[model samples]
Target: MILSVALSASLALTGSPAHAATKPVTFQGFTIQVPIQWHAKKEGVNLRVITGVCSPQAAECQSFLLGGPQAVKYASEGGPYRPDQPYHPSSGVTECVPVKKYNSGQATRVRTSKAVFGAGQRARFTEWKVSCDGSELNVASYTQRVWYVKAKKVIVVDHWKTPGLGGILAKAVWS
Candidate 1:
């Protein structure tokens, strides 16, 4: 009995069950592999809708928003939609970053670079660190991967200090 218990504990600790295959979750016209145990939900308007997902214990969920090139219609300086912007990876970071962070204080765009996702699709990747006002113990940080596919669509992948999720986005598959 002790041996069985130890074996079970080891399996749980090693997360052998969590290594099962990950199914692809589709949002808008794009699809990406959501890591095991992550949850996804779609919200917002047709062109502005985003399928967001996060680990159960995560503080913030990541948003997967994809739209046609003409979907740049920003309702406000920080609204989730941008109808005036072009199709670029950086554009996704600009539109997807919450406006409240900017309104609170200065948010830094820490880094930006090029990336590839899903069958060699090129994209723009960016990272941000937001320093809020006051003595708040927690601050906001984000990493975004944007893909402007030849289909004339823009795909934005947003995460908050969550590692590996971006890697899943990097392996996204378009249908």
Candidate 2:
């Protein structure tokens, strides 16, 4: 009886194993474990992961994208998307901020570092701060986090600031 009580306490303290609560999501030969509640869909050459509430009309919604080489090649309507450059999907203005009537302008790189993915793969991690301007002045700002694996031609872009995402990527298992 004492042993059973102690075992229950230990399990309660440590919680369940991470994998028990998560589901593996694979994209472009890379795999990461995300919460089971998250939904994923294929959009062209990219895998779109919806993490939160999103609107159909919103230009940028509450989600992230895992892109392959083909997706990168045509990320921008005007030209190819470069990891070093700011994320501009089109030449025209895009409403990135959740608030209506606000338009996004040039995004500036705020941070850059090396991020590890499945196995021992290293990626260029960049955080961009994009300003959202109203008709008169800047209304708000948001960060765009990107992990680019040049060797595998895979990129992960996140604008919703999903919790524990970096750690999840770090613990990924590549296939």
Candidate 3:
């Protein structure tokens, strides 16, 4: 009884299998694990899916974008869209440039940095701070981790930045 109790305590402290709350999901040609509260939706004609913290229709939301085929080709910089090519990390860094609007009483500020994605993969982290003439303001930040998994012919984008999004992406399984 003492041994069992000790083992249970250790598992709880280490976040063992019993403590993991995520569920496995298969999309496009890869599989990943996500929290039960999160939901996935198919977006665009291409093999793209957006998993959000809330329902897709929710007003305030953030999501992870998973794209297939052509998306991988377009992920690289300095090249035309070529569905047959893979993404090259050395090509260039992705930027987060939001166009400033004309007198909309709203201004947006974007900040970009380098962050680690799943398994130490380099990713672009962007924060968009939007404020209006009024007292209301919003800051949205997400990490776009794009990689061309040649075997799968897809470029998975783990667009994290919201609460719990990074944890979900950290445990993601591409296969």
Candidate 4:
């Protein structure tokens, strides 16, 4: 009985083996565990988590972004990004492809659902698809996922499709 209790305590403290390689990342009043290799950087009023390869010239590299009310208010081409609205991170032509002269068109919402974060905190989750335009039309495409907590005015934007990120966010803890 004593051994079982001790093991239970250990499990509670360290989590499962799958989480052994993760580290807690805090933003605003929320925290989530992400792979230890992921690097977090502060960008303006937002926090960006670098998950994969990135380009120095790309406006948005392969990573995710965490933002507060201020960042959300001006997230889209200096406009607001409401939960019910479409996502438009930038205006005019923006670089979607790392290669030179490749640009991206508008982003359209493809899927949306209710998501949970930070100890059952509810959020609006959405996926947007954008097409890359270069020498040929619709050369390539990418998906951008977003989770918005309206009451808290917090948002998580992921464009790189980082594995297990959604599950990590679902298990977040709020402070």
Better of 1 and 2 by TM-score: 2
Worst 10 residues of 4 by lDDT: 92-101
Q: Give the worst 10-residue stretch by lDDT in candidate 3.
A: 95-104
Candidate number achieving the greatest TM-score relative to the actual structure: 2
All candidates in order of TM-score, best leading:
2, 4, 1, 3
Residue by residue across 66-101, what tens digits does model 4's lDDT show? 999887787677788866554555665666744434
Arranged by lDDT with the best first, the candidates are 4, 2, 1, 3
Clashes of each: 5, 0, 1, 0
Give lDDT per model, in order: 0.49, 0.78, 0.46, 0.79
Candidate number achieving the greatest lDDT relative to the actual structure:
4
**What ranges in model 3 sit over 4 Å off?**
1-18, 45-60, 76-143, 162-175
Give model 4's TM-score versus the native structure: 0.80
- Residue pairs in collision within model 2: none
Q: RMSD, each candidate, Å?
A: 6.9, 4.7, 9.4, 6.8
* TM of each candidate vs. truth: 0.56, 0.81, 0.43, 0.80
Per-residue lDDT over 1-175 for candidate 1, one digit per residue giving the tens place of the 0 to 100 score: 9999999999887667447556667765567766545555544432222235444534334444544433333322534333222223232233224424432334456666666667657666655454443345455434443444434355563444455555665777766
lDDT of 3 by residue, 6-107 (tens): 998988786775466777667664456776656666666343333454443232235556666656555545443333232222264332212122111232
